[model samples]
Target chain A: MSSLSRTTFASLIFGFSFLYLPLIFTAIFAFSDAELAGVWTHFSLKWFKAILNDEDLLIATFTSIRIAGISATVSIILGTLAAAATMNTPRGKYDGYNFLKRIILLPIMIPEIITGFSILMLFMVIESMFGWPKERGILVVAAGHSVASVAYVYATVSSSLASLDQSMGESAINLGAKPIHVFFHITVPLSWRAIVSGWFLAFILSFDDLVIASFLTGPGTSTLPIVIFSNIRVGVTPTINAFVTVFVVITIILASIVYFRTLCLKGRRKGRSATR
Target chain B: MSKKVVGFFLFITLLIVILQWKVKDDYSGEVVNVYGWYGIIPREIFNDFEKETGIKVRYDFYDNNEMLEAKLLSTNNGYDIVFPSFIPYASRQLLMGIYSKLNRKLIPNIKNIDGIITSKFGANGGDVQFLVPLFWGTIGIAYNKKVVSQLLPGETIDSYDVLFDLSKISKLFPYGVSFPEEYIDILPQTRKFLQLKHGGESVTDFQECFRFLEKVRPYITKFSSTTMISDLLSGDVCIAIGASDNAYRAMRSSKAVDKDIQYTLPKKTGILWIDCLGVPKKAPNKRNAYLLINYLLSPEVAAKITNHSGILVNLPAALPLINAEIVTKKDICQSDPEVLEGLTMGCARAENTRELIKAWSQYKTNTHHTSINKEASK
Candidate 1:
């Protein structure tokens, strides 16, 4: 590698370390068996044991997973529909479509505090007006996460659609396949990668959130992030470290799965096309 | 092209329909939403009051007081009641200022508050209207006597300085020590160690306090040990600097079981802390809020929490309700005025507050890794 390339590589390594060092430190302490708190000593599975045994933590994690799953699926559907609708529109309507797209992206692009606050206000207003179940806060949070995720899905899928051969759709119709059948057989399957990417984004955003969760959350509705956030002042204990390390490991594993799956799908698509 | 415009019109119409249907559901007023810090008592106290009063209460709590403040400034938050530490409440001009007066006229139970606190801030702030005294206490060392005496045979365990002596520390203790992580309180802790004044809101005596903490750095194993009090009673730790009320609770439970635990107001003084409750200026249910405040301050209610939580109460009259063992301890109420002042000054050292935090942060950053090693080596 050239000297400049070596320097750039070093910079990337430094950047990754800078962002992730604290998390690594936290992981180390999670396994710490030190008598007095502070420095890491000999490693132990004590904290990990405490976390695995916590029924509340497990339940909270389950709730978060269910919420994330529902949100990701919903976001993918909404995003794909919006993208398809916008892509086929006339040149005169492009300005209006872009405006609407910007609105969809607003929730994620703006500060999280602002987005969370506005949604919370909307919920409070609705609660007062309609006397809805107070657990509506969960629905609101899911909606917020999905709305943010939709923009990412739409952007990715719209670009994918732009790259797709439109002649396939025309030929399918000419061959007596109805529009709906063509969509089901061709459009959706082709957009699966974008849909899955959207799902991943939506799920991660909902799970990692703290600020938005804190604002919209009510009694008995605390997600895992809120639970962990509240316990910071209680001081870092083995149980906390164990809980976090497990959470981190699980996220890393799932992210890798998503990454490898995308690569595999892209490879299969390329192989099929090349053979044809 | 006209067909495309027509389709766009249809889409906009659908969006409008959905928005309108949603907007139609919003109401003007139905609940008095209360956002406050949630914990042992603040979590449960509202339930009783909500039941007694017909005004429906919607309450939520954040762990940190700053989170509460942030919510108040944001439009999404519409809290009728906000409970914040008096210091932060005083500092912020917009979110607070209503607390400048105790207005016993509104809350009749104010008559029973501990004179030390209510008189200091209740209608008594220096032209700054910010908070009512909800609760107050000093920071001190809580210890298991057997472990402590064994650790320090000839040397007396009386000052904050003792925490710096590796020779005196207990090997039995798992967590060497713990303190709050708040930036505001960190500085004062250092200055008070050096007999310095806060000077004013900005902090004056921090340098001296910082120097002292830096001096004591290696001796401290960890400061992120808020749960150390619980550990101390379990004998995982011999001693820790903690809230008086936390110590009292540990001792009360331990003594009943025939276990010996002691909490001390160090000879050099400890930190004093206060937690208070107040209704916002634009509270949705102001009358009901006053009623709730009055109800909590009622002698019976106040006494129940004080005894249960073991924290010092704001109402001096409620002092009688404090766990009998803690109030009756002779060592805590020293014969010497100097020692008593030192203990009282523990939380009140406004002088060196800033210096304390700098020292703590520096220590936390520098010696951050060695805490567990020290324990393991021992």
Candidate 2:
């Protein structure tokens, strides 16, 4: 076992501190009793209690989560299908397949503001023409988020799918299995990890989105970021800090659960192999 | 593996369906959608309105006027009611035909609106028939009393001189002086101050305002609008040019931190800022919007809003019902008739907006003269 050099050690410390110091301070201040976020007084749970009473903030949080969940699900389906279609097709066999690959990645290339604005314009045009979607709301926001995140899901899923051995799927096809059967049994199961990771990525992207959500959100559909951003005009209350602290704690707990579950699964696999 | 995957997806599908159902359940009833500034109106008022009329209020908020304008400009924004500031946003939006002609009959309580604010708004080309100028406040000087007193002994901090006067502001510069982020906040006040000082001839030129600002620009420690309250409370800035409502908030919070924060309407030239309420032209629930607006207009409701939010609502009848703390605080709610009369409402003409924005950005980023001289010499 080799130790890290002094330069590497110092750089690693600097990098971690740079990334985490603000979050650490935010979590610290979340417990402060002072009205001003920057000031530190005594520790208090008043802000945590205040969050429960803040019906608007709670509603916004749920709205954000719902939108993220719906969009992540939609994007995962769309992205997986797009990835399979593009990856399974033999190179240069279809002219449009190459074009499709390039076009699928366009959303990732374009800036989010432009994507939000253009999608908004498209919705307006559709409304004027077809008179459908009568109003922008949660659905419109979810659709907009899916459009922005599907490219990311596609990127993640495709890169992982590309690394898989193509012979497995070919052999399944050779053994008289249908394309659907092969996709479900072989392609999907093998790339399940990538699909799950992609779904999480899309979920986070949609959850953290402010620009696209702002453009598409309508009456009674303000997302969490929109709600928090609006509080800036009047100084942001410490309740938001408490809210964020709670969110961080939940994330850490969830992450640890996943870590231990993976560890347990790995240990079980080792035990099965050893017994065999 | 496939069965587990299928179950996972089914669970997610069920969760989404339940969420969608929950979100849509509230829309089954009659509702009025309001878009306004966050924390301006208390929740109890909305609850009271709901209990009285059985019409639920779906309130959404935006921190800035631009966000509200963006929605209004878009097709079918679905907002039954919106609050836009009078000077630039509501005034400009009115010209774009975004607002519907409010039915005066629906809002009979409109008569309770203060005459002074209405007239002041009207002078700035605000039409009550379209945009109802309801929420109002002043843009003034908010300073740390202890810091300012120590910075300039024997000096009263009642006027803009403490900020605009280069000599006086220079002394406070070390302690830290903050300026408004928006050009509109300070430009009009600067114009008024110059007009009062120079007999209103040479100062009429906007260029003179910029030149005057240039002298004090070097001394400004930071340019901010939203964080002024915390800045004042934290002693980050000894003095800041900010909105009266924010100043009131700072003053209220300052006590908890053991700081003496005071806000003053510039004695010579105070700027009146008004937020107007109106229904978008294509509002889906115009009737409910009218009902909500009228409910808000009632003196008791308006007074409750003012009391809870520190934002002054323009209802003369609500005056007596307002808290003494807000009413007594002359800077927050100026009850003095003479001073109130002198409060000028400033609006940039539609054509001048582009030029004003350009000038403001230039002023914000302009380098110090000495630095410029050094660069030129180099």
Candidate 3:
């Protein structure tokens, strides 16, 4: 048993190293003095300073974050509602709930380039017909990202909803609780963890998107990924390394806080249930 | 509060913010979108232009001429001024009536342009009003001098022969050569050397061009449009077939670390590419666009662009203001009168572009297999 556990641990170490070694090298290169990452002349923070001073990059980052936050929130709300409605539909009825599920997940099934191009064409047609969205900007990017993120949110929320005891909700309704009150008071408290996880997953998907954002963005509204990609043609500058390192650090901190808080809450709930 | 109530509040807050938050234009004043290749326009130039004219210059980049063409075809994208190379891309667009005629009266600084510069676009520019010449240079070889000397002692650095006849030098630097990935740039030089070898009469069709590329494809280790300089600096590639600006940049970058990166034009003749600025027909800010063009044509601005971008500026007035190191170097400027006689300039409409694109795709697929097989063997 000990030997088997050792072998398993070794393989896990190897697997994780393969995944994260490049990011480690990137972080090291972010602080390197030379233009190329091969040389290690000394430590430097000039690239970080350069990134701060670059107005274009800052504006793009702001646009990316703003779009990601809005899109993720929108996706979570719509996805949870859709998932709840689909779950409530009787399994044998097949009364268009199945169709609704398939259509809602269609954007994720389609290739990203196709999705981006189709959304762009749709916006173009709408613009021509009704003069809506006269200009392509961050809002169009949010719309595209939200559409793509919805499926992930729906999958997570609906899977958790399916595992829950429907009898609990029925009992709450029977005890004179209104449908809305039961949903808010009973159903939501039970699936809160999955809902939060889905929100974060959607957030990541929207935040890291490049292809869809590229099609939807127009003049004066470049995203961080777009700017970084364009600048890379001049050869890989350390500024992008610095920018990515900062992004990674923020993500780690936020994820850590969420993970620990969830762990603590779960532990406290277990203790409460044991006492009961 | 219940988690559901909190989630509802967060969702509502986000909706309100997204709906209320607008994508404010970065520039408040008159704006002109200048689309070109990456790093073609330096930041200082934009700031200076904006300060001088109060017309905010919004710059964007596309990796290839095809993307630019697609964008232009798809939308009246509100781009005022665009900078593009003459042949293959812009020339094709010119034929389609995509570019607007310039109002010469507004651009008084056009007088500063040399005859050679004006004529470089077309036969007396075909229609001088269509585009203004920005910078011009020859496409040639950027090679590591030490590597070349050891490869072939007593051989002169000039000639497309070293690149085309790679079988002879394969032993010296096996799998050392690289070419730009773009066929638009590659085909012109490939055809030039092919004509030089087989005479103009023998080299007739796109098949011949494709054939030459195939013959030399094996010796090429990498075909990358960017990273030409970094590749040289890292010693991954000893020689690259690239345009003047990149070649100059590579040489400068390598020299900073005491590496002797040398650039040479083909001995007797070479292919020339001229980057020009033209306004789109539906440009909204026509007056500001003209002002920007005229300002760019001014000797100081022209000279700054040349020095910074490392392309040859043809404005004679700006010649004195250019970096002396570049203006003085023969390989960089290519000003030899006798050698000038041998140079072949690219045409406005070189050939059936569809055929050219097809041949290029075939070459790429063939090369891809060749490289894969070679890699597997190794």
Best by DockQ: 2
lDDT of 1 by residue, B31-112 (tens): 4565553333543455577577655555554777757765555433445566676664433432344433444577877666
Highest-scoring model, TM-score: 2
Among all windows of ten consecutive residues in candidate 2 chain A, which has the lowest summed lDDT? Answer: A1-10
Q: lDDT per residue, candidate 1, A93-197, as tens digits?
A: 568887886776665578888877777777777776875534444456677667666777787777887777777776888899987776666766766666556
Pairs with steric clashes in candidate 2? none
Tens-digit lDDT track of model 2 for B226-324: 999998888889999989999998888887789999998986688889999999999999999999999999999999998887999999999999999
Question: Residues A1-276, candidate 2, lDDT per residue (tens digit)?
Answer: 159888998899999999989888888888889887877878998999999988889988988998999999999999999999889766678999878988999999999999999999999999999997887888899999999999999999999889988888888889999988988888788788898899999999999999999899898889999999998888978898999999999999999999999999999999999999
Candidate 3, pairs of clashing residues: none
lDDT of 2 at B136: 90
Say which prediction, candidate 2 or candidate 3, comes out ahead on DockQ: 2
Top candidate on lDDT is 2
Instruction: Assess candidate 1 and give its TM-score to the true structure.
Output: 0.62
As a whole number from 0 to 100, the lDDT of residue A244 in candidate 1 is 72
* Sort order, TM-score high to low: 2, 3, 1
lDDT of 3 by residue, A160-226 (tens): 9999888887787778888778667776777887787888888789878878877777665566777
* Alpha-carbon runs more than 4 Å astray in model 2: A5-7, A91-96, B196-204, B367-378
